[model samples]
Target: MMTGDAELSMFPADSRLFEDSFSAENTYRVSGQNITIHQYYCANLGVSASVWESALHLCQFFESLDLSGKRIIELGAGTGLVGIVAARLGAHVTITDLPLALAQIERNVACNTPLSGWPSGAPAVCPLSWGRDLHRFSSAWEFVLGADIVYTPETFPLLVDTLVHLCKDGAVVLLASPMRREHGAQDFYSRVLPEVFEVELVQRHPESNINIYKATLR
Candidate 1:
């Protein structure tokens, strides 16, 4: 149940959510700046429905926060839309997903960002496989961002493991997802995430089915 404005914030100037296919380009406009992202709709290689509704929720969250100069890393970055926005907002951002998504993420980052838009230049793209690849990154981030990532049941444990290793002690972590629990994601995340970090539910707006959580290491 997204608000009208929230739904509009999900796409760019000329974007259509359900026309053609997910491979169609998506446009996003924020604070007078514009960005376009391309998404591959295939899920077999670990890519799923291109852009998600929770991403819109996260974008709104970005507008409300002061992320200036923060070291931010986004796990499960699909099209890198949120990370691109974070970089554009003056954070040193790194966007990661499975290895297959690296090239597309890179392309989106490039297409959406101008040379002058990113205060710290472009976002770093990394191929992350959760528990198996936690060592590739230094565990010293000021903030970690995730959107629509808490969906798969089998990946839950590894996702938590990666989150624990990425954030510094007491670092802020923000995660958002639609309360779709068909695969048992809601149950697992709500139960286990608090074990490693102190968690609080963030109320963004009244009508969103998307749930946002604010957590910090204990």
Candidate 2:
């Protein structure tokens, strides 16, 4: 848990952060497999179109776990990197985000075909807006993942509601995000999340200012 007030740097919430003026595709090597992601920088899409450092850290953390045959669903799956990695590691993954973000995620999933020869099938891409259409999804997932999804305080309640809905069947939730103090990321982890679930800081990559949290229903 984070303590006392400290002069923290602000996490730029500007949409310009998503702009990659260089290449439309970024390649990442995860779990010994190379996953290429296609990203869009439409200002209307906000941060949902780009892959953040938290997603990369989550992928690194996933490398340490045996995700084979696990039923996983990822929320706010920007660019689908974490879910794609989980699928590559043999987990049955469903990667979801807002409706507009699905196209890029679908494209990435298609780009990484035959994920690790699992033969189970490719990841399913869907649209999920927090706190809405909760019944459209099942609560039987074995694992729920979110990377960099806590930066917006306005969505904190909805995100928590969605997590609670998804974890009703005892599914474990893994959330990874940079502690962006300016955006209340710390508060979401330290205060908001703990209010509903038993939260534990499983890993902290201090060099990258990212923390991976494991949570389950209280």
Candidate 3:
């Protein structure tokens, strides 16, 4: 029941109820920007709004910077919202997610296709699984973006390795997530990334209920 320029659908189990509950589709309205993103189904292995909000703030921060010509890649792009916004803001952005989630991300990209104006090029949607190879998207990007991707101690090392592998030296790495569960990811970044990355807390959103962080290659 999403009625707009976007003919988006919902997951079967959650679709009917969600459609009936809200008169309009839910969207993230980025501050200081005219762009907005609409999400339909959150996929099976979904990320929360706190993550999305944090990513939006980080993206806004990126937009505020001088990135007229820079290569960017977004990891764990559940619905491609952050990547799309980055592309619109003139970064050569590549969107990656689990293969299973690629279709929905592509759909969301297509949904906002007209609005996303990357003069350099359109953002490429690629498959990238953590702890796996990332050669297809190339090994160079000025910045690597991730939102709500860090979770579970088991995946921490691999995520770090992946980031280090794909990002070039001096590349800025941006990550946003809500501190969830008892996972040691916060500690891992605090302890480990300093060896390779200059980590900094950019924004803590109590209103949006998320924490957005920025890290740069050291």
Q: What is the C-alpha lDDT of each candidate?
A: 0.75, 0.83, 0.66
Best by TM-score: 2
Error in Å for residue 58 of model 1: 0.5
Q: What tens digits encode model 2's per-residue C-alpha lDDT throughout 52-161?
A: 98888888888778898999999989789999989888899999987767887888888888625645568999988777768899998999999998887867887899
List the candidates' TM-scores in order: 0.83, 0.88, 0.77
Cα lDDT of model 3 by residue, 34-69, tens digit: 444444443333342123565767766764576666
Model 2: residues with Cα > 4 Å off, grouped in runs: 1-23, 115-118
Q: What TM-score number comes out for model 1? A: 0.83
> Is 2 or 3 the stronger prediction by lDDT?
2
Superposed by TM-score, candidate 3 places the C-alpha of residue 33 at a distance from the truth, in angstroms, of 4.1
Where does candidate 1 have its weakest 10-residue lDDT segment? 6-15
What is the TM-score (0 to 1) of candidate 2?
A: 0.88
Sort all candidates by lDDT, best to worst. Answer: 2, 1, 3
Q: How does residue 40 of candidate 3 score in lDDT?
A: 46
